[model samples]
Target chain A: MSSLFNDDSLKSIAEAYEKYEKELVPEWLKKLPERMEEFNTLSWIPVKRIYTPLDIKDHDYMEKLGFPGEYPFTRGIHATMYRARLWTMRMFSGFGGPEETNQRLLFLIKHGETGLSLAFDYPTLIGIDPDDPMAEGEVGIVGVSVPTIIDMDIIFRNIDMSTVTTNMTINPPAPVLLSFYVAVAESKGVPRHKIGGTTQNDPLKEFIAQKSYVFPPEPAVKVAMDLIEWSIKNIPKWNPISISGYHIREAGSTAVQELAFTIADGIEYVRQLTARGLDVDEFAPRLSFFWDSHINFFEEIAKFRAARRMWAKIMRDWFGARKKRSLWMRFHTQTAGVSLMAQQPWINIVRTAIEALAAVLGGTQSLHTNSFDEPFRVPSEFAAKIALRTQQIIAYETGVVDTIDPCGGSYFVEWLTDEIEERAWKYIDRIERMGGMLEAVKKGFPQREIAEASYRFQQEVDAGKRVIVGVNMFVEEEEEDIRKVPLLEFNQEEIEERQKQRVKRIRSERDKARWSTALSNLKRAASRGENIMPYVLEAVKAKATIGEIMGALKEVYGVYVEPPIY
Target chain B: MSSLQSISEEIKAKRPLKVLVAKLGIDGHDRGAKVIARALKDAGFEVVYTGIRQTPEQVVMSAIQEDVDVIGISILSGAHIHHVKKLMEKLKEIGADDIPVVVGGTIPLVDIEPLKKMGVKEVFLPGSSLKTIIETVRRLAIEKREKEKLLT
Candidate 1:
């Protein structure tokens, strides 16, 4: 592995860099001083004024970066990235009810959306029926509520499940939701092999960051693994678990935290699956990831590159994965939702565009650009269209896709990529020593770290160290005013009542004996330490609600109570 | 820093007001709530956080049992109006309505007025600074303590 620069040339470059920083910078600073005392990335990584060949003299290009579509996929996971295929412009759409979100999905597809990303409401996410007391006023509010297969039927009534891949953002009840999708597809005569989509069956992130977890970590992961193992046999094209970092970042972890914690979570998943005697190559290729493309342009790009490269090494060296596809790190990226500010909401369009560009440059497989009105409410149709158009404009107009790994060889990008990869590996190693993410999460290690980081970031913004235009920096005189921005109106009572009645009617109309027997079988399977996917599928076919199947499992697994931290 | 110092002094002058910081609904976006709770604690208030998925009834019961001077409910699920209404009703039913309730989250401006009319003492939306939140909660806690003293 020869270095990119020879020793003689490198020494010359190094001496030149030293003279420039020591002598040239002092003279330049005497005449015109720099703006800030210290410049850093949003994650607080110190940044230098400029990067040069000397900065990356030790790097071996063929060894470190390699070519796109090769092992150690630092350049990218694919050779002809956007030139051959564009990233899926999937808008995370859902609100009011299943029918309403279905309309929005169709609208997006009509407007050139390449894939569908569904967002379930709170009750559905935590495995509660709309009629449950805990679901009061929350039904169909944030996202589509699918308590049973009936609602799932309405959501994809005419849409061909085989044509477009749907990404459901449900966590704890992921198995039940996947069963409903399978049942719906079978009812529509689409075979199990042809059914395609991704169920975000990741429960570790639910416990660690999302806080929507239902059962305790061990049993929750068991249920998630059940879905993944079953899907490997049945739905060959489906990605069972999108091990996600989007929620972690949205929960206020720094960029490196998002990378390290998410990869740690993925490593835990692989260990859990391999413990069950399944071959690593069987499921590793179908495994996918999700990340938050934050506003820190170069740092975010480097983070993406680092994530791909790190995951490739982990799979190859740690897991002994020999398949080329198993070494590929394919992931979906979403522009940071937490970056959107309520004040001067229109400027959020610019923020989204910039973040979307970073995702494109980072070689994401699929991307979701957050709507500008996210901070105000569920995005209005007008705002969501603009968000989709933001991706379209970048793809067609920017000429960024004309080449693969456009920012692959830059000195700063390469240096930052290595820096982030090294920092993230240290975290992963620490978590590995602490007996992986589950044990670390149980000890509240990651949670406390995230809380500290979030608090410090808030303090920085408050002290005017970080400039969030229209938020803490650019003073908007008419602050707290979102009147002019059109908002999506929701009739909470009507939607809640409609969802409650749907769940109620499904319970009464279905074959009661079949539903009860299926639920009992599911409970027995869960208790006997058997795979719960077939039993869950039986329950879904019998018209059992998500709450009932999950409730049966909960009786065996018990509910997990989050200990207060912060 | 000066305002924070004054707020701390005022709390110290009093018996150190206890506040309930809670995620009333099922929404798990508690970054703002936790940050605000830490800020209030730093500002010399005793904060009892009811972690995520606490129903309004549970929150009201905790507020009454803890005898908090203020209740801060964070909801990002757009169900703030629904939960706050039930919370206020529960508080009124339990005769704990005097405990000032402050709501915060990604609440739209249209809902703010209704939430305030529903007896929410203050509504903090997105972009609300920690400084503003700390000062507002302090003022509300003092007002509630004074009203309780008058009644006693």
Candidate 2:
């Protein structure tokens, strides 16, 4: 790779920078005091007062960051980018029962949402029915609860499955949810290949951050791969696994850790698929990523750019991917929910808007902007609308979408991209040395790293080193009245009661013989180490409840107990 | 040397405060709970974390077995109202009701009063500083100790 600047030009720029820091900075400090004693990005990367060509003197335009949609796609995966078609506005919507979540979905679509992102309740997320005693007090609390295929039907009622793409944010039981969705789509006469969407079927993240794993790591990964293998043959348009770093970042990893661990997880998935005798290009194209657009604007954008370039290189060079589409690091981004504040909750709107803008400039294919009030509770209808509008404003009014990779060539951006890429590659190399992400996770590498990062961040906030507006710095003498903000209210007892009764009714009404047979077949397939998707699809069609299907698999696979790490 | 001796004596004289940081129900979000556990440990308290996806019964049993001074419940799944109510019931049933419970997470302002009425001593929302949480837990532990003395 050739350097962008010649050795003489680099030396001149370096001398100029030193002169500016020594002579100009000292002279200016006499008249104006510096804001902070030390300035750093959120990831603890030291930030210079000003960036110049000296910062990126070693950068090569072609080798480091090629043109948009080209090899090692640092600029972007798409040539036209948003200039041709804006990124998908997929606002996450779910609360109460299926009916209520369905209503919210319709509301978002009516207000110009380009795609749908479903959030399941805790019970459904962990692959249990609402009626389970373990699921008591949790049914339909966080998101929509789908205890059976009946509930799935109700959730997608009257919606054209063929026209819209959906993303379901569930893991561990993602196969079960995917099965239910496929059954629903089939019932609606939508062909399997025509129905497009993504299931967050990444279970490695479950152990590392999300903590929603059912079986132990080895078996859990097998089930996740089952979906990927099934999707390649069955649902061509569906993304089987959205290897997510969003939750990892939300669980408090740094941007580099998020990028490194997520890409590592993606590599693990590809390794598993290809090991199954499937070609890499066949499954790699559908493998998508999910990232968090955090508070730091430039750092977040650079993280995305670096991630795309790294994944493209990994696919082409390491994995020997032949197709261009296989090398594209297509991703969906959600603005950091942890960045939202409960105190002066409205300020979260600004935070979310800024984060969304970073995601757009960073070249995300799809974006979900969290509502300002999300830190307190599920977003109210009004708040959800505002979040969707935030994305729309960035797309239509900002004029950023008019250009491709708008921040591709800035000195600071290029430097930050290189810095983040180098740092992330170090972590990936470390994980690879541990054998792979699965072994790294079993050894609690990422878990411990994330925990330490989280604690350190809290310490920074507590010690006032990091000034969180309305949290550690700005004082509100009197609490603002939040009564005016409309809150989403749902009767928990009633929702649970109705869900329980529905589950019972489905069990009683379904063909009992077929249900038992389908469940038995699922268990057999699960124990035999065969692909469980076909059996899961059969069980869903048989109206076997989520609990029953998961129960059968649990008998064979057993449950996972995460090793305690502090 | 005398001051250091006094500090050592102070540490030896009192039973170190023990707290159980737990996540109940199907909520897998434990970043806050884990952070609180570490912070309390740094503040000279013995913190026992129950990890994630723990049931209310399991949490109460752990509290009894650990003989914790306080129980801190961190829930972000918006299931606090249901989980906290069940937890309070379990604690009472186990006769550990004197062990004060401090709830934290994405708790709504509207639900705060209800949770407090249901015996949640303090509710910490998203922007709550670790200092505030540590101070509140310490104060609650002291109150609980006094209440146990009165009952005895």
Each model's TM-score for chain A is 0.99, 0.98
Question: Model 1: which residue pairs collide?
Answer: none
Model 1 stretches with alpha carbons more than 4 Å out:
B1-11
Tens-place lDDT per residue, model 1, A70-161, is 87889889887888999988989999788998899989999999999999999999999998999998888889999999899999967988
Query: Candidate 2 lDDT, tens digit per residue, B119-140?
Result: 9899998989999999899877
Error of 2 at B58 (Å): 1.6
iRMS, candidate 1, in Å: value is 0.8
Compared with the true structure, model 2 gives a TM-score of 0.97
At residue A16, candidate 2 shows an lDDT of 88
Off by over 4 Å in 2: A1-3, B1-12, B147-152
